[model samples]
Target chain A: MAEAVDVAGLVDRARDGEPRAVARLISLVERGSTALPEVAAALAPHTGNALVVGITGAPGVGKSTSTNALVRAYRAEGKRVAVIAVDPSSPFSGGALLGDRVRMGDHATDPGVFIRSMATRGHLGGLSWATPQALRVLDAVGFDVVLVETVGVGQSEVEVVALADTTLVLLAPGMGDGIQAAKAGILEIADVFVVNKADRDGADQTARDLKYMISLGRRDRSGPSWRAPVVKTVAARAEGLDRVVAAIDEHRAWMTEHGELAGRRLRRAAAEIEAIAVERVRTRFPAADELAARVVEGELDPFTAAEKLISGSLGE
Target chain B: MAEAVDVAGLVDRARDGEPRAVARLISLVERGSTALPEVAAALAPHTGNALVVGITGAPGVGKSTSTNALVRAYRAEGKRVAVIAVDPSSPFSGGALLGDRVRMGDHATDPGVFIRSMATRGHLGGLSWATPQALRVLDAVGFDVVLVETVGVGQSEVEVVALADTTLVLLAPGMGDGIQAAKAGILEIADVFVVNKADRDGADQTARDLKYMISLGRRDRSGPSWRAPVVKTVAARAEGLDRVVAAIDEHRAWMTEHGELAGRRLRRAAAEIEAIAVERVRTRFPAADELAARVVEGELDPFTAAEKLISGSLGE
Candidate 1:
């Protein structure tokens, strides 16, 4: 059995901006602690004050660099910032690449800035599922802004959008034009597009393509549609980051005004609740192994098997 | 009411290798139709005969070309083959890239080959959830080989491994080295590594890097270790494909001999059954919306809210 930490004490210290306390609280969330109800109660009073921003893009698009730039931008505005990078690397290696990228120049000494790279390899579907709660920890711990960075590879990237006030989709030249971006399903999730590595030769072309794609994909035109603005940035040099921040702020304001923020949070929380409940139900399904054998042997079809498993576990 | 398709008649036609029947059965699976129970009952007896090979990689890795080559290879051996490509493109767009790639000139006329590109963007988490059932339909329809291809952007790609007897992880010369491949979470799922477009520069380097990375990431040393062999292939030109086929066959034989095939199938069935049951539970949780509001308002902790919602729904 894992040792029981003092949830109340941890939350109090975390609220007072103690790094150790904050880290411990986040670890509880990361580990999906059995004491989550107490921890959630302890932290509930302090959340909903921070702005959560999600930064995501395909590999080689400099997502980490953009996140570092965004963090600096938020810090420059005199706001405490926390970074939670969802790394795809294995737990065995601790992901050297993500680590190096997240620990940007001179970030270690900054008391106002906190960075945590959560390993996604700990369990299947672990990091993304854990991230929303971990964000709550940082929010309750007095961070003015929490930046969530994810490698845009999977369903986790989609999940990140539901948890954020603003989602920035990053793309570079030759990764694909805006049409290719649309094909990859990034078009729907992006509140703003960042054409990172804008100093490259095809930067203007990429921007134009994105703008065109955005126009074509504008889902609603009856009301004031949130046009996903494309911002060009040479993130490696920290150029054009101001506009990216500006776009995020604009999107955040729009979401707030249109009540989309509340809707997104409600949906995210509901999804989280459902996920936890389903996991609990799954734990009782020891008979699933035998049921699976029946399906495999053609003794029963999958639906009847599934119905039995659910009824057996949920007592329905 | 979807005008009821004759479930038994479709099964009979599908077993007789009628393309239209196979296509309609797969569509029912892809759509998560109300008739799925009937479909499963009809198709259950015909499954467990086909070999499922999952081909996955990062986008632009020539996965389609490789799949086409594999299909042809299977055809040359007088085996019927089916290609199910989980395309990321939205259904509104009809996935031109996936379509053009899958059409494979002259092979379109060959009824021996069945090609279906499942649109991943139809619904959130749709393709992965639908794939196993679709595989069941194809397997039952008397195909000797089924090549399941995915762009591998997320958790869905990981889910594919549960259904496949052998998983081929594709990489190219310029798309990072083996360490980069491991970072993308492909190392664990890969049964074989194919360096496609191998005529390009750094092909040898990519192969060497993968071999080195595999040696480093060897998770088990006690039992008969399945070392993922790196093969070079210019798939577009159909070069080095014989070696690829040989590797896949060898892996398939090894899995069957080890009883791993039965174990994998049972686990896959259990997972599919679990996913279905969870979805059923989710559909009953209307109180989740109210609970979400309380969590967002900080009036109730999320964990507490989840417990209440689950108990209310499941009568726990």
Candidate 2:
């Protein structure tokens, strides 16, 4: 499979903004193909230009509608946009959720917009391993902006924070989202917060709740700490989207000013490198099954078995 | 910390059912302390005796209440039980959910019962890494049954499945739990279906929905397959508790009869060993930050940086 992929030609086509070529490249990344090294090497020099934004919220927090609106907002500025909707809960491949896809129909025929949905069904490292590679593909292919939207369940919200240059944590009124967000540990990662469906009954209350929580936690760092702004939006009508976009841009500007953008990107790269390297080492230890059998039979402990596996494979 | 630990002495005390010794051993595991290898070595040869049961469900599904009832039922059978309540969402250490700890007050003073709450917090491998070690500590300490109850959010339900000999997927009536469970990709991992809060309306409908989903997928494997039994209970009042216990025992018996028990344990051990090996490899790559900086500066790609880090460390 690796031998069949013409990495250079595909990279060239992707650079030229051929959507098919871009899709194929992302497929390779998503599948964690053996030709990834070649693909990455080919795409390296042209990367790092796109502004990566991550939008995440719980299942009913209007993430898809918000993403659709954000895509339209970015396109109005004549910026080419790419959207990667990630479903950490769904393990199936090649199929996006039907409802979300229908809502995104506005972008189906637009040449300036690219939208793809990915599921981490059988991937061992989950989003930590695959999403960055997909981001790298979109970044290298000349998309001016890339938005990663993930279902905010479990650890995916935290993982998305690592992948984005700016993260938008979406909430809706009367859902007790403020408490849920804090309990899920996502409140600290937000560069900007969007209270979508702001026309709801308790929109002001939710916004006030978030501001109160922010104030309690905000002693401010020694340096200028970016205060996560809360913006209200009725995404279905595309209302309050300009402020959302402006808030995102302001956050990006703040990150650049603090040199925090480079620092975050560096940390993301480090994590990506560590995941790949660890996966490589794991595959080298083919005696895992036999060792595991010993462990099951109580003949060896797992830690000792792991140590033996490592030494046998790495000759350490 | 490792140098100060008397691993052998702690193991000896733990084997004698000293609660303090057992607590210390679990603390070491939870902290991923340097003494882990010593602790594992000490615990080996005395492990694999306990029946590991995993109970999981979404928030407000009565996981803690169900667990509380299960503890009472097992105690009635004169079997020693150890409950590990894992909250993957909370990152706090030395602090369990206060409400859950209060709910288990019935067993707090029972000499034969031990209950502990763990949070992933800063732990890199999450439940996959720590929960198994905690189980080993309890198993080696002579518990007849170890119940691993986790908050079923995100990827945790799947992870808990990997750790249990028999997994009970809990749901409540009137919550559209059937569809929610299916979407969360948890329906397949359940070895036993639990519809708690059976006194509520739609309990029978929920049970029917589960049975229908189960029937659609159950064509019987190549051999005799153990069909997951949906057991209903009003755990708050302890109504129908006996049936839930019976279902769990029956599932365990069926797994043993089919030799599936050994197979599950083998797979679990393999995963545990792999997590440890991967974590060790991750620690050896100290040049990651420097390489990541270069990648962030657009001088190198992450894949190539990973390759260099691997080869430089492993000399492969």
Candidate 3:
């Protein structure tokens, strides 16, 4: 058995801006450690204070560069910033990527900034189970802003939206046009769109295409809904980043005014709670292997096996 | 109330190779219909006959062309083939991709060939829950071969691997080298490797790089293990596809000899049963919304709320 963790002590240190303490807390979340309940109980009251921003886009869309730029922007405004860079494709997890840190430059030494990369390899429920817990950790640890950066592929984009109060979808010219973005379903979840690499040749056409698509999609909405604004940025050179920041701020303000922020948070909390509850139930069913063997031998169908397992475990 | 489905009649027609019956059964699986338990019970005994080959590759890697070529190759052997082309990116779902049909012209009219495109948008557990069930339906419908094709990204690739008897990972010359493939964790699950678009420049270099990486990775394995063979193919032109077919056959034979085939199927069945059980538990916990509201309001932490929910719902 693992030794008991001093959850309250860790939370206190984390709140005092001790980076290692914050890192340890997040590590517990990532591992889905047994002490998580104690940790959650200790950290709960301090959370709900930080602004959670989700940044996502396909690979080569300048997500990390834009995240670095935004971290600098947030830091300049005298706010402590934490970045949770989630690489669903990565199998290894440690601190932030060295390559990304090199691009991020001076922020490495700044005490006000913390960066961590999370890998979802071999984890059940993947990001949906771990990410929100990590966010709660950072939120409780006194970060004024937390940026969740994830690859925009498969279900990760949707999962990120479920965890964030505001989501930014990034695109680059020549990578794909507006229709392709819509096909990927990014248009549905984006609170703000960032057309990164604005210096590229087709930047204006991409932005125009996005605006047209946005207008086409908005035709059916009856009430007041936030129209996602498109902002262009050459993030590598740190050009046009101010507008991206402004758009994000505007989105936050709009959500706050319309009570959408509270609604999103409640949904996120519900999702987190449900994910945890399902996982707890999963652990109680140890007969899954035997049931599966029977299924392989053609003695039972999968659905019936599932029903039997549920009743056997839950005593229903 | 929805009318009860005549699942037994549908299964009988599906077993008789009736295309409409097969399609309807698969549709039920894709939709996660209320009739799923009845469908599973009927289909269970007839499954375990088809050879499931999972084809996955990053976008721009000629996955569709390769799948089309392989379908034709299997057809030439008088094998009835069913293709489940899963597009996680596409929100629209119906039959096959029309563009793919243009390339696979003759097969569109072939009575032995069946193709369907499934979209994972808004589905819980995404492909993991649905794809295996669809595979089961195809298996039960008397297809000699089932080719499951999906984009290689994030967790979908891993999920596909779990559902396939043999998984073929495709790569192109220009789309990152062997190191990049390894970083994506594809190297671990691939039973065979196909270097599609081999007519392009640098194909030989890409093949060599993959071989070197494979050799490096194999050094740690102690006993006899399947060394994934790298096959080259210009799939669009149907060049060098015979070797790809041979490689898949060889992998299947090797697995059967080593008893790994039964092992893999058992694991897949276990996963399916567990996912269903979790979903069942999730439905029983109607208190999740109220619990989530409390978490959002800081009246309860998520882990504690989850604990309360499990106990309340399961009477634990």
lDDT of 1 by residue, B1-316 (tens): 5447789998998888788888889888887888888899887877789999999998899998899889888888999999888877777795744584547574878999988888776753476568888999999989999999987557768777877989999999998898888788888899999999999999999999999989988855678868888999999899988898899989988888889889899988888888777776676577678887877887777777766755564232
Whole-structure CA lDDT of model 1: 0.83
Candidate 2 vs. true structure, TM-score: 0.70
| lDDT score at residue B238, model 3, on the 0-100 scale | 94
Ranking by TM-score: 2, 3, 1
Give the higher-lDDT candidate: 2 or 3.
3
* Cα shift from native, residue B134, model 3 (Å): 1.8
Cα lDDT tens digits for candidate 3, B1-316: 4338999999999889888898899888888788988899898888899999999989999998899999889888999999888877655653345645664576867879988877766575678778889999989889999999986576777888889999999999999799998888889988999999998999999999999999999999998899999999999899988898899899999999999999999999988998887777677677778888888877789988987776664232
- Backbone clash pairs for candidate 3 read none
**Model 2 alpha-carbon miss at residue A301, Å:** 1.7
Top model by DockQ, which number?
Answer: 2
Candidate 2 error regions (>4 Å): A1-27, A53-131, A141-161, A167-223, A227-250, A281-287, A308-316, B1-6, B9-23, B55-126, B149-161, B168-223, B228-249, B282-287, B308-316
Report the candidate with higher DockQ, 1 versus 2: 2
Q: How much lDDT does each candidate structure score?
A: 0.83, 0.85, 0.86
Task: Arrange candidates by lDDT, descending.
Answer: 3, 2, 1
Name the docking class for model 3: acceptable
Off by over 4 Å in 3: A1-35, A38-255, A308-316, B1-3, B57-78, B87-113, B122-125, B151-158, B169-189, B194-213, B230-244, B277-287, B308-316
DockQ (model 2, Cα): 0.44
Which of the two candidates, 1 or 3, achieves a greater TM-score against the reference?
A: 3
C-alpha TM-score for every candidate: 0.64, 0.70, 0.66
What is the total number of backbone clashes in candidate 1?
Answer: 2
Categorize the docking of model 1.
acceptable
